[model samples]
Target: MARKKASPEDKIIDAALKLALAQGWRDLALADIAAEAKIGLPELAHIFHSKADILAAFERRIDAEVLAAAETEGIESESPRDRLFDVLMLRFDALGPRKPALKRIALDLAGDPMGALSLIRPALQSLGWMLEAAGIDSSGLRGAIRVRGLALVWAAAFRVWLNDGEDQARTMAELDKRLRQAEEWKDALSRLRTRKTDDAAA
Candidate 1:
């Protein structure tokens, strides 16, 4: 069936997110949201009917925006070494408080990794693009090696972002450090491949 028009439920979601950003996720109520949204309780209930429904809508709303923003950014000043960081920059911007919907989605990721993986695909695809753009053609290399190398870099970046306890300054430093290490590994492998090619010719 064709989707119904936007309703007061959406307004309540927007209001809740605005309040959550203004305050924090820990405090928000249906009545407060209704007031903020300027919608009557019954009208909001007719669409959402419960707090959970509103929150779900809010998260979905956030996730879509974050993805769209990343899509718009595409990539920037990118190298194979720093592509993931650019992706992170775009995502973090989208994750700001005013975008409470995305905040909810992020909070949910800790408990729901399958969902998180779905959310993570854009970053992965961005990394893949970086690899291709940098002329690292997997088809020209050993398939297993290419896959494993990319997987390692991606996994390390994801883990650091998820669990690093350092302050933001140190964290960005670490991100840069990790990118350098990934580039170093790629360089080393290329040198080894060149040596092997010379050996084969000899």
Candidate 2:
């Protein structure tokens, strides 16, 4: 969908993303974004309190979109691995077309989350619900730990997907590795719980 630049807020966010893509965030300024959007600084400020505010808006906007898409992945395949594969593929499809800007947004996550926990914590809750719905054992798994693990999976898989240049073959290969690693991580976490239980008994 073409971004609507109808409102001052929309225009500013669009401009920031475009400028970030072209010249990097370091090269972007509130004035530059205002100029790109053909709005005045005062106008931009009226719509968004600050440049950081605009970035938070952009990050949050896409975060909601990607999270919804991740949730709506209708993959009832026999395995969670297959479901994960389908989810990752859907995100790639959605993000791949957006081109220049969304990819840059993905890269900026590490540097400027604005409220990473605010976004990701909810996503983790949703994913955990899905996992329980799928009959994945949640016993002994703390939501915070699960959330962090899931975030790592997302961040690592994103790095693999973003830089992949091999017609998606490499991307799928990377996804597969991540999937296997997830299983191993799950096992390790389960063992950690068991060892803690044994230490308590001892």
Residue 81, candidate 1: Cα error in Å is 3.0
* Clash count, candidate 2: 0
- lDDT against true structure, model 1: 0.58
**Model 2 lDDT per residue over 34-112, tens place:** 9999988888877776656775565555555555665565457788777666655655665575456757755665576
Clashing pairs in 2: none
In order of appearance, the predictions have TM-scores of: 0.43, 0.66
What's model 2's overall lDDT?
Answer: 0.66
Off by over 4 Å in 2: 1-7, 49-52, 67-73, 102-141, 198-202
Compared with the true structure, what per-residue lDDT tens digits does model 1 show for residues 3-95?
876666676777877776665544456778788989887777777765556655654554466556656666555464565565544443444
Off by over 4 Å in 1: 1-84, 96-123, 126-167
The lDDT of each candidate is 0.58, 0.66
For candidate 1, the per-residue lDDT at 102 reads 41
Clashes of each: 0, 0
